[model samples]
Target: MSKIVLYWHPMSSATPIACALAELGVPHERVKVDIHAGEQRKPAYLALNPNGKVPTLTVDGAPMFEALAIHLWLAGQYGVERGLWPAEGTPERLQAMAWSTWSYVTYGAQLVRLQTARDMGTPDDPHGQAGHKAMDELLALLDQRLASQPWMLGANYSMVDLIVGSVIGYSAYIGAPVQKHPHVLAWLGKVQARPAMQIDA
Candidate 1:
């Protein structure tokens, strides 16, 4: 077994990575970086991740950063063996990669705009309205996909579901009006019900 250490902070983007680790049931070490205290910006942490973000993983002393990249790598390395990742060179694998990327790249982009607008207390502004519109379109796409299948990659649950679901769930948490999409709400409920998805806030 590789020596895996996860550097994380509470209630951040790192939460999803922690959830993934739990689902995989991998034995690893957890190091909390107190972003509130600026620990993430310290030189020691920056050496491992110049981005100076939480949720950096060290596998046998080699560091990897970025929440999405870490999730993909973990799914490939640990999740494949645990039946939480699709096999390599398969259509399901391709779909997994695509949907996972869409969750972050396509959906996450609009979500950020919405969040920024909300943080600035101008959620009713044109920028916020645009973000909401884009998000609704994206949610409709997700709803259509879930209407045909139980999970993201079909019948069985996988890391793709976790990855996509987490992003959508975060949007809903931040007031994205996700309840309007029934199919998406239902699918997200199922994903969230997993024991491994539970985390301390």
Candidate 2:
């Protein structure tokens, strides 16, 4: 098998990491961890990623976790430019990283929390409602931003698109609508149309 093995679960955020790898043409074996079955809680997964999160990749024997970090490393190492990043040190690069951070740290957290509450049968939770509000505000902010730039970092489809696009997919899965942002809808349609954009576990 290839040295890189990606431990993932379909029910998690591993989808974006997979999309990034597919964008880069990096072939890795998918180690399915039954998250619902508590597979990720097993000792094996904990050894790889103490956090027990999906998208933990063992690249050439080195373990790397977190979807965005893995994608950034892959983009740099493989020279795969799906418009996910720009040249380092340039204005474009700066903007791309900013948007990428916004997607993961800001928007992604809110969406994940909302989904977690609903998945654990806490759909009507007060915190979940707050998370939904955060999500809506984030989407509105994103929509306003997209009103100008074609992509998150100017008119290019860098890692920003992959990251944000994946978040949009998650929100949709949790009953959050993406139709409100016309630009996002158009951009997401393009991202999802990628042949390598597989929803692999």
Candidate 3:
């Protein structure tokens, strides 16, 4: 087994990775980087992740960063055997990859914008409005996808649901209009109810 070490902080973007680790039952070391204390910018942590971000994982001492990349890699590497990830080269795998990327690139981007607007106390501004609209449309798309299914990749809850659901759950927590989409809200509730999602990491 490869020795894995996770560098993370509490309640930040790294939480999802921690949750994934828990779900996979992967035994690893955890190093808490206090971002509030600016430990992330220190030279040692920067050596692992030049972006100076948490959620950096070192597998056999080789470092990898970014929550999306880490999640996908974890699912591919460990999730297949556990049924958390779809097998490669299949339609379900393709959908999993697509939705996973969409969660980060598409929905996550708009969520950041909305968060920025709110942080600036300008949620009613044009940029904020645009972000809100984009989020609504994205959530509607997710809603439609879930209208007939309970999970993102269909009947079973897989890593795809966890990946996308984490972002959607965070959006709702940060005051996104996720409540407007009933299917999404319901699906998110299911995701959150998982024991892995309940881990405080």
Candidate 4:
């Protein structure tokens, strides 16, 4: 087995990758990067991830950063038999890719904007309000999607759910209003209930 080392922080977006690795039952080492302490800015860390983000996974010395990339790579490397990812060339695989991209590019962007507004102490500002509105629409869409399926890809909990749920969890932590979307909330609850998720938490 290739040696795997995951550099992460407890509160960072890296949470989902950690959960995915745990769920896949892959053997790996966890190295916590203290972002709050400015550890991510260190020269050595920046060499691995120029973006200076947490959850950079090194597989036998090759570095992979970004939460979504790490999840996809790990799933490809170790999760096929476990079914954490859709099989190659399957329709479900396309769905997985689409949903994961939506999670990061659409829903995640708005949530990040809201978080930025809050960090700037302007949660009620125009930018913040726009972020909130965008998030509301996205969450509603997710709720509608979940009304017909148990998970993001379908009845099974696949990599898409892990990746999407992590970003939504981050949004919730940053105070995105989740009360109006009961189905989404319920699906999140199920995702959060997983033992691997608990370990990541």
Backbone clashes, each candidate: 0, 5, 0, 0
lDDT for model 4: 0.86
Task: Order the candidate numbers by TM-score, best to worst.
Answer: 3, 1, 4, 2
Residue 143 shift from truth in candidate 2, angstroms: 1.1
- Model 4 spans > 4 angstroms off: none
The positional error of residue 142 in candidate 3, measured at the CA in angstroms, is: 0.4
lDDT of 3 at 129: 89
Question: Using Cα atoms with residue i matched to residue i, what is each candidate's TM-score against the true structure?
Answer: 0.97, 0.85, 0.98, 0.95
Across residues 83-110, which tens digit of lDDT does each residue of candidate 1 receive? 8898899898999999999999999999
Q: Candidate 4's residue-wise lDDT over 1-201, tens digit each? A: 999999999866777777888889999899999999999999999999999989899989999898888887887777678878888899988888888889888888898789889999999899999999999999999999999999998888877887888888778878887778999899999988888888943
Score each candidate by Cα lDDT. 0.92, 0.77, 0.93, 0.86
Where does the lowest 10-residue lDDT sum fall in candidate 3? 168-177
**lDDT string, candidate 3, 1-201, tens digits:** 899899999999899999999999899999999999999999999999999988899999999999999999999999999999999889999999999999999999999899999999998899888999999999999999999998998899998988998999999887789999999988899899999999978
Ranked candidates (lDDT, high to low): 3, 1, 4, 2
lDDT of 2 by residue, 31-147 (tens): 888888888888978999999878798988789888888876776666334445576768876776777778878888888778888998997699788888888778888888888
- The most accurate candidate by TM-score is 3
- Indicate the TM-score of model 1: 0.97
Candidate with top lDDT is: 3
